[model samples]
Target: MKIDTLQHTSHRTNLAQNIARVILGGFLVMAGTSHLSWSRAEFLAQVPSWLPIDADLVVILSGVVEIILGLSLLFFTSRRRQVGWVVAAFFVLIFPGNISQYMNGIDAFGLDTDRARAIRLVFQPVLVLLALWSTGAWQAWRKQQSGD
Candidate 1:
């Protein structure tokens, strides 16, 4: 009975994770599309001005990357764990943009106030957690830690 219950719970968890993964992938694709087209300038507001690279190019490249990562999350089941790690790392890498947005007080994406921009910074870690959890990466890490 315990084993059966465990199996049932595991199945439900997978189902939930799969749903989250799909939703997150869709979001990434949409955001990536925006970066390439209508929302390009808005994204520029997040770029750190002190960076030497052109903001436009950075936005374009990161947009392309977002699209690719989104697709991977959707289709790369065999490598979902690695993709999760990559996606989480990507979120970490872009955290500076969120920080820059808050520090510079550049209004974009309707983040018009310091409080709003500061609030937005909190979501980056959530994205990282979502990527890891939705991909079962967190489970795998736990297993590794337990030497199972």
Candidate 2:
């Protein structure tokens, strides 16, 4: 009876994760699309001005990366753990842009107010957590580390 209950709970948890993963993937794809087209200008606001790299070029390349990552999340079930890590790393990589926006008071994405930018900064970790959680990467890594 305990085993059955455990199995059922696991199934439900897996289902929830799968759904969250798919939703995240879809969001990424949409965000990537916007980065390339409709929202291109808005994204430029996030690029750190001090960075030597061309802002437009950075945005374009990042958009491509986002699209690829999103597709990977949608189709790379076999390598979900690795994909999750990559996604989490990507979030980390772009965190500086969020920081820059706040520091420079660059108003984009309706984050004009300092309060808004500060609030946005707080969500970066949440995205990292979501990527790891939705992919089961955090749990898998923990389990492997524990040698369980």
Q: Rate the local accuracy (lDDT) of all candidates.
A: 0.86, 0.86
RMSD of 2: 5.8
Q: Which stretches of model 2 miss by more than 4 angstroms?
A: 1-13
Worst lDDT run of 10 residues, candidate 1, spans 4-13
RMSD of 1: 5.6
Q: Which ten residues in a row have the lowest lDDT in candidate 2?
A: 4-13
lDDT of 2 by residue, 76-106 (tens): 8777777888999999999999999999999
